[model samples]
Target: MAGVYFYDNQWFEECPKLIGPTDHSFWLGSSVFDGARTFQGLAPDLGLHVARLFKSARSMGLAPKETETEVERLCVEGIRKLPKTTELYIRPMFFARGGFVVPEPESTEFCLSVYDAPLPEFDGIKIRFSAWRRPAQDMALTNAKAGALYPNSSRALREALELGFDNAVVKDANGNIAELATANLWMVKDNVASTPALTGTFLAGVTRYRVACLLRENGIAVEETTLTESDLCNADEI
Candidate 1:
């Protein structure tokens, strides 16, 4: 695992800070966050990552402090702060502080923190069919990468793990497959690729976009359409 971390200029400190005595993010689950990576000494598709973060913040009505250019610079500088020879997983978040009682962005405080953790190795995942379905946009901020939505994912994952599976594949309210607990999913069929379109029920991931583009560039016809559990289990001979 790498041993370097990075954050914005605001949280560019030597030590971590305490948070969430009664934070709304902890209590009411009013927060949003996004993850992107840097590899081979460069952050691939960095601008898109930062843009998504801002989009996530706006989706949740949060006030993000850093511009895209500032975030881009900080990401690079953060890598420089780490040892030159180490591979790193860079994460940044706009969190809430003192965000209880009344959850207003003006009253909210924010910070960023990064740490060294191994990138997950998904050779293949054994997914369990989750009974816990995702909320509709009418009921939850399902489209945004909000902290509140994770509890459902966490519960589904915990249930799946208890049942001897690696992860949970949650369905939408109508019993359509949504995605894995964390990452978006793709199913290959007949030398072409297909994935669930970004309905209001799921976050369209940055990596997912890149992969689709790469596949399209390589002459594979990538289709954005709804996929079901049956579709995955029975993809035509590829």
Candidate 2:
């Protein structure tokens, strides 16, 4: 389950072997990463994940050295290097290296790593409403999937677990559903499917996007709109 990883153009035989956590990302928490999956020898929406990584890196002011095609090829190459029939999590990360402890595009590091793991196959995830609200829009990394932003989510999920729930449901400052701790949510009611609109607070996941497409193609009415706490509590199913 452990192997060398690629960073820029070099292979790190031993991780954390790179020089200088001198990067402000180590101190200022200014890094962004994206996740995608390859299953059954097919990487559905792989391109979208690569595109998203670029967008996230751009938002964090880190320059991405890999083009979409390059990223996709690396993903395939990394997976092929693994044992046959293995499932895995594919993470690509980008970080800023210099500049006043504030994240800027210069001196960026593009790291791509793969870890063996099974894809999530939860029949359903239970949830408790979180008292903690997502960071405000004024926050620099609210919706960027940056490492710094995950602590807030982690704490909320921990509290939910302590309270005997399977997952936590985070709300924005406006008290609308943002997302679950680990995955986006969809609620089905009266033959309609609904998910929270991207209100600039949560990640609209790749799997969620594909599911929406399948539902639309099947003539299901899918609505992207604001959902209040009451909407979830009243739902027949989620």
Candidate 3:
């Protein structure tokens, strides 16, 4: 994995060891991050991804030292350091270094990593419905792209993979369809595309929003509404 990382006001070819045992983020999981992809010299919705990173930091109770524009600029600069034709995953992260049970907002630190990660070929994936469910808004930090929240998703994904499926379709607390364990969910039925409506249970991914817009612009009807397992079983495409 060829990559470049920017941390502590310097760029590094190797990922620097930035966290330790006592670090708030390492122990308490006070971290937030966002991923954006660049391929063939085009990065769609990079700005939106950067903006969401800051929002996630705030939601996680960490303060970001850099503005969204500055982070986005750093991302582009990092991309330029790599081959233009390489497909890359751009990740910007914020973590807290201080506080015991609660993270100190002033102890936030930031890092940016850009790495070669080719997009997966579209050889359709097998998905199974998972027993795991997303937490209600009050039960967890559902609004932020926080690392603490991923363990549940990891468990769901692991369960699916163990059952010979590529991914799992997770549900919200009410047992309504929420999303795939790793990404937003979408289905097509009767020539209309639909996704689970934003219900504060899952992150409304940047790519998902972009896809919805593109579909609508191309004369397809896209709907955001509550979805059920029955809908998934009957969908023409997913």
Candidate 4:
């Protein structure tokens, strides 16, 4: 887990400053985080991830001090300090400082935690249909990758784990399958790949986009359509 953090150009490899108890992010959940990955000395899509981090913060009304270039530079520098053979998760986060209901955007704090973590193999995953569902866009800022939105997924995951499953397939307010507890869901039939359309219920991941493109280029049709629990389970493959 050897990596580093930066606070105003200063690097801290250990014992960095932590969020306070009353911080808006800690108390009111005014925070957003985005992740990128490093493997074999290459940081793929770091720019897009950083850009999305800032976008997520802005969507939640928080101001990020660092630019995408700056964040990417810091990530590259941090990855250098870690073991080259080990995979790493590069997470850049932003949080608000003070407010009652709405956060003070100017009080946003930033941290980039690049830590060594192994990349899981893409063998397969076990999923169960979870009882917990996602909120409607009117009920929450579901479009952004906000911290407060994650606890619901965590609960769904806990329930699935208790049932001896690896992950849970979450539903939306309308009883449509939203996604798995951790990622977007895809099903296959007759060599065609289909996934649930973006409905402001989950983050649109970068890998999903690239994979869809690659599939299309290779002549495997990919469709973004509404999906239900029944549709997924009844599919030829998932």
Candidate 5:
């Protein structure tokens, strides 16, 4: 994909090889990243996404070298390098290069990649209930956007794809609906929108929060409560 990457105090037209096989992030998965999208010359919630990236870094015990303001500036700068009309996925990442089982906080390094990735059309997706469950907050780095957490989500997604579905609705350890494998789960019933309450098992995305706010502002009822598979099956929309 066509992109601009910022790494090691320089910008590259190509994605530079910044990590080795022995790097802590490569071997032990001590990495955190956040994604924001820029489309139609607008980037909504860019600051929230950037702030979450740093919060994730701190939760993963990595000390990021760039301030949140600096990271946001870099994202904007990277976005400017691409065509104004290009729909892009902007990602800022922090990874560790050293330490054994636990990553060395001082070994954290940061990079930003802005690439052409058009938003998918809303054709609606078919979803199946996955056998997998999200880890509890005490069981994993549930508070952070840590790289290690994605394997379970990928497994759920793969199983759904294999079963001829586009995505999977994953549940928490308590067997309540958590979210979709790729995004937050929402359902509409009698014009009311409801989603799973944030219980620390899944990441409550920036877009999800914004959507809830917008719905409420427009006089739509949005509820965050425990959801079950039966709720999904009975909903007017999902």
Candidate 6:
């Protein structure tokens, strides 16, 4: 794909060296990443995504070497390097490059990758209930956007695919509806929209928050409350 990646104060068309075999992040999954989109010369909510990346790095105990302004500049630079007509998934990643025992935050490395990835056409899809359930707060570091949390999600997705479904609706530890395997879950009932309240089981995504705010500002009532799988199956829209 036509794209560029920035690391160690330089940009590359290929991946850069940020980890080694003994790195804590490589062995124990002590890494975090955040993504934003660049399309039509607009990068909506870029600052929020960057801030989240910093917070994720800190929460995961991986020190981020660059400041928020520096990261933003790098993102803009990488996006500018790409073809103007190409839409891209702008990714900023942070991970431990070296450590023994536990990951040392001071050893963190950062990278920004802007690659062409077109937005897909929107069509209706199906969601199957997955056997995997979201972990409770004490079970995993669900508060952070850490890479470790994805394995369970990957299992959910694999299960869904085997069932011939487009995605899976995952449940929280208490057996309440948490979210889709990848995105946040929203249900519409009697023309009113509601999503599961943030209960420490999943990442409360930036897009989900923005969508909720937009709907409320435009006079469509949106609610954040506990949801159940049955609620989704019976809802007017999801």
Tell me the TM-score of each prediction against the true structure.
Answer: 0.87, 0.91, 0.99, 0.94, 0.99, 0.96
User: What's the true lDDT of residue 109 in model 2?
Assistant: 78
Give the clashing residue pairs of candidate 1, or none. none
Q: For model 2, how does the per-residue alpha-carbon lDDT over 45-131 read when each residue is reduced to its tens digit?
A: 878988888887877877876787887887778777776566767887888778776666767777878767786687866689999
Name the weakest run of 10 consecutive residues (lDDT summed) in model 6.
15-24
**Candidate 6 per-residue C-alpha lDDT over 117-211 given as tens digits, one digit per residue, 9 for 90 to 100:** 88788798888998899999899888888899999999999888888898998999999999999889898998789999999888879999999
Runs in model 6 lying further than 4 Å from the true structure: none
lDDT of 4: 0.85
Query: If both were scored by TM-score, which would come out higher, candidate 3 or candidate 6?
Result: 3
Tell me how many residue pairs clash in candidate 1. Answer: 0
In candidate 4, what residue range of length 10 has the lowest lDDT sum? 1-10
lDDT of candidates 1 onward, in order: 0.72, 0.80, 0.95, 0.85, 0.94, 0.88
lDDT of 6: 0.88
* Candidate 5's TM-score: 0.99
The parts of candidate 4 lying over 4 Å away from their true place are none
- Residue 201 in candidate 4, Cα distance off native in Å: 1.3
TM-score order of candidates, top first = 3, 5, 6, 4, 2, 1
Query: In model 3, where do residues sit more than 4 Å from their true spots?
Result: none
Clashing residue pairs found in predicted model 2: none
Q: How high is the lDDT of residue 80 in model 1? A: 73
Residue-wise lDDT of candidate 5 within 1-238, one digit each (tens)?
A: 8899999999999989999999999999999999999878788999999999999999999999899999999999999999999999999999999999989999999999999999789898899999899999999999999889999999999999999999999999999999999999889999999999999998889999999999999999999999999999999999
Candidate 4 per-residue C-alpha lDDT over 7-86 given as tens digits, one digit per residue, 9 for 90 to 100: 65677888487689888899999989888887798987788888888889988999887777888888888889888887
Which model scores highest in lDDT?
3
Task: Check candidate 3 and list the clashing pairs.
Answer: none
What is the Cα root-mean-square deviation between model 6 and the actual structure? 1.2
Q: Which pairs clash in model 6?
A: none
**Sorted on lDDT, highest at the top, how do the candidates line up?**
3, 5, 6, 4, 2, 1
